[model samples]
Target: MGLKAVLSKWFAAWANRELEQIRHNAVQLQQATFRQLIQQAANTAFGHDHAFTQIKIYEDFKQRVPVRDYEDLRPYIDRVTHGEANVLWPGKPAYLAKTSGTTSGVKYIPISKESMPEHIKAARNALLSYIHETGKADFVDGQMIFLQGSPILNEKAGIATGRLSGIVAHHVPAYLQKNRLPSYDVNCIEDWEQKVDAIVEETYQADMRLISGIPPWCQMYFDRLSVKAGGKKIQDIFPNFKLFVYGGVNYEPYRTRIEESIGFAIDTIETYPASEGFIAFQDTQQDKSLLLLVNSGIFYEFIPAEEYFNEHPTRLSLAEVELNKNYALILNTNAGLWGYSIGDTIKFTSVNPYKIVVTGRIKHYISAFGEHVIGEEVEQSLMGVARQQGVDVVEFTVAPQVNPPHGGLPYHEWFIEFGKAPSDIDAFSQQVDQALQQKNIYYTDLITGNILRPLVVRSMKPDSFINMMRAKGKLGGQNKVPRLSNDRKLADALADYVI
Candidate 1:
């Protein structure tokens, strides 16, 4: 056996052992790990500032730190940028994971020494989880194409800063780096188009067994690879392509397209990773829910999503979370982000084993007129209507049409990028509207009371979202267009939201 295979086997056993222990007592593990982190960092500035030493339990932590978002932590982050050490973590973070958030334009999340091992462990465990279940470890012997950002990062006071993918690129485990394709030179090409071209050139004939990325960009690469190989499916080019590791967005809408591009069905593992941390990952093929990272260097809390917009909401610990309720995730990390709201909403599919499904983004919703429609609801409705109409949605976003130019009635507007346009656009719009009304009662009340007109469906060119992504320089890797915009900011810019 080759060195890579032997290495994979050894790592798999170690990771799976750690995973099994966490699963043994997920809640107890989270509780203990959280306390240990607080105690370890009690001497640090942030910890001392928050009285972490005085905090005995989750309740004490809640009382001391309170929930915060990126904006609230900006001052601390700014201090870090100006070379302040131990502001958030024990020392200045060696790297920052930069992201353009849908709401917060730019964010610099600290990647601290304390959390580096956790990040590495989560990634290894994710891959090992799949191997443990499937008993397929041969792919590690071949290439694992990581579709990532430019690896060359700019330094801020001796601290590296770039997209999370780039930050991770600089630290990929030396052994696994051999299995990763696209030379550092190719990866350092900042231009997305040029970088993608270079990656294809380097890996087109390599022994590619796994392709991992955000689905859209990976699909883009496959499309390019097909054209380069005279319209052959990705499977034709990489015959042993065994797994597609994907994250950064829901895979349901893109699954059909990706499978078609690949020419054969391949196993896929979904991960819930963010600039803040690697949150959870799919562990079992039989069940679709992701197993929460209870023992990672992160402490978790949740506020009921439906109640968060109220004057006050309850913040619950891991043990307090109820099954199948949408909750906005709050995280306290070893990286020194105390009680930070990650902004994503999730639902627990299995409370005992701590399995979750990402429900929506807290800031990404349509609540213009008190009819709060979330991302999960919108996606389900769109997926259902498309399936019914025998169409595929390339990309989509929904917004509230609260004001009409001519003082006309208000409505919900959908800007849809479709692979196959419905035979009758009007009929499709009705289906979307009705499906939403059936799912959301407040929406039904709006229609029943004549507060709004029928929802609008504007067919967008398939590449419309791509154009927007290109303009944002966030075409892939943990960056995603919000599925539901509470305001007209993004919808208005698209022009398709215009009634």
Candidate 2:
């Protein structure tokens, strides 16, 4: 290692100590009474700014603020439009993290100096939690590989305007920065497509051990790593990569493929991440639920899905949520995000407080033709089908298409990809149709007889689906094949585009 690398290592050591202190304090506070915790958080926020000091002001304005989303905070973003301090925050923004969702067109999320430490702490805690769960604290002292974006710092010196990822890159620690990776400065990013390509290239050559990021990106990294190692197994490249930490989006779709690609059935932990902050991380070994970061200097609330989508929506605190129930997440973070609904749906896996699993994006549900379909339902159904068929599935996506029903307008359709397409496509389709009917009774009622023939299943090789994603310029990074579609437009479009 060079002098800079040595310094980076030293900095990491010191950072680890600081992280331990924070974790210790956080756990102590987390164990405190709920009311006490809330008061502490309120006090902390108050100390952080005068705006928060006036409890009466916040109380009076809290309910009146109207639960907000990214779009609702557009004006706040406009205040810090050029990294300059305005109504949003007190100081100039270091950089912006660009994030995309159904409604928000590439949102430029600001990361301030005060909030920067929290983001860094969240990233560190994700690793720490993985280590604690896997008993791999000592393992972290070894060569670690992070399959994340390039650590390249952008030359431009202002908050990025549109991209959440870019803005996040700007706030990363400058001392621990790597010269070989891509810049984190979103302001300097002009050609995003080229940047993604560059990221893939460097990831292909880097010596990595500790892997991170979304499962889709990890699949792409494994592909590149496989090629670079001359098809050598993952255990050979990074035998020390005993732990895999992933978040951002769902991992169920690519679970088996990743285990196969990495050539090891290692300890894997999932995280709930966003441009705003790290929401939760898997605290247990089982891949069922996540432990919400209750002590992470943020206040959380949940809005019942029924009420959130209806005329009157009421917010519930962590104390009000129930086990095995789904709700929309509303957050109030030190990052200046208040009453922000991130459009994610989550369920408490256990009755114990602070543990939940992100089920799906609220808008990602499919209710076309009156068939209410959820992501978990579709995933479970796919798992059930795979079990019944006795075949291992690497990856799959469900796209709803429509063709004319006899002579009038068409009914809904299904498109699926399987590891081994059954010998009889027609029979397999029938089984899938039955599975859908069994999963959702509404679909059963719609198709009285052989009304809508068996849903279509398109079998492809292991990487074929990922390749299709790549062809769409989404390969080798954080993007994944969209799981559920509302209409046939995407399915119809995929027919010609995907092989």
Candidate 3:
């Protein structure tokens, strides 16, 4: 066998062993270890902070750390952006994963090799769980597809120069490299402009069995592939393409178009990917994803959604976290971020201590549709509609907009990009509306009041939204398009979002 093939085999075996060990440790030592992790952070980092130290000295310890928001970290981030080391911990971070900030300029997030284990473990577990849950791995070598930001590394050297996705790509074990489509090594080096051409050039001939990435961009690439193959259809291009793996953002808007263009239904897997680390992945037949690497290398904290929005919210330790509760995620990782809120909301689906569902962004609310649809609700509704339609989609997203009034009432708008074409758009929309009504009572009430109507699907050129997000300085080599924007500013700023 070739060296790459041999490495792939060896690495897969090693990764599986590691996952089993992690799972055992998570179940066995989770509680005490989690507590120890908190104390360690306090002693190593938090204790050094004057404010935190003062609280400790005063015997005024709160059950949780005072809640932190992005704004709260601005001073530290400013220091980092301007080349501040030792702002949060000792030593300079190995790299900064540049991502966008709300109402602010760019954020250069710190990343380190110490944090690599959690990120790598999370990724590996995603596939393992996918296989265990879907029973697909028993078949032929399942080809996997990853739809993500271009893996291109920054030209400059140092942590500040590398994107999170790029850094992860760089560290992917060489053994797994053999199994990855588009080869992470190759994809991680090419510039964005060269990527589509590269994908079109290679993937057009690939018998791709698995696909992964953000939904919009995936749709865009497949659309180009379809056209290049003279409308041969996605199935024809990659008949082996059986599963779609997606994360980084919601898949509602682009699902319909992706399935339509591909001319067939395909199984989809969703994950919660963060620059700080990969946190969760869909593992069971149920809608919720299993927390894959809880005890891998990071200690987690949760701030209630309500408290998280407050000026000074408090966070809960993992020991205090419970099920079916919405909370803003705070993370302390080996990467050196302490009490850091990653700006996402999540909920535990069960009390078993190892599964979660990403609920929404702290501030992403959709009132245009009167649905008040957040990320989690939108995902549930989209999946419901897709299952009802017997549609297996690769990727999707939902954007609420003011529909041109038919009778003086604004309607909820949907900017849909899909791979498979459903037989009926209006019928499909009604189905979506029904699903949302069932998923969220507020949305149903809004629909009944005519404050919002069923979703209106707006067709755009393939990759329009993905390009738009990139243009707006919102997306980069590794980040994703924001799921919900109240004004549809992203929809209008196509040139800027795409570049």
TM per candidate:
0.95, 0.77, 0.76
Per-residue lDDT tens digits for candidate 1, residues 1-499, read 5667667777777778888887779989988888888887898778888898898977787788877889988888889988899888788897888877655787889988878777777877888888877778889888888888887788887888898888778778887788888888888887777878888899999999988898988888988899999999888899989899998888887887888899877899999888788899999888878999988889898999987866667999988989989999999888888879888999999976889999889988888878888888888888888887788888888888888777889988899888888899999899888998888899889889999888988888758888887876766555677899877887877884232
Model 2 scores a TM of 0.77
Of 2 and 3, the candidate ranking higher by TM-score: 2
Model 2 gets an lDDT of 0.60
In the order shown, the candidates' Cα RMSDs to the true structure are 2.0, 5.8, 5.2
Candidate ordering by lDDT (highest first)? 1, 3, 2
Model 1 lDDT vs. the true structure? Answer: 0.84
Instruction: For residues 233-325, write the lDDT of model 2, one tens digit per residue.
Output: 777766656777787767765676677777867777787777676787775686558767766656677888757776568777666678877
For each candidate, what is the lDDT? 0.84, 0.60, 0.63
Alpha carbon deviation, residue 221, candidate 3 (Å): 2.8
Winning candidate number (lDDT): 1
Clash count per candidate: 0, 17, 46
Find the candidate with the highest TM-score and give its number. 1
Q: Which residue runs of candidate 1 sit more than 4 Å off their true CA positions? A: 1-3, 496-499
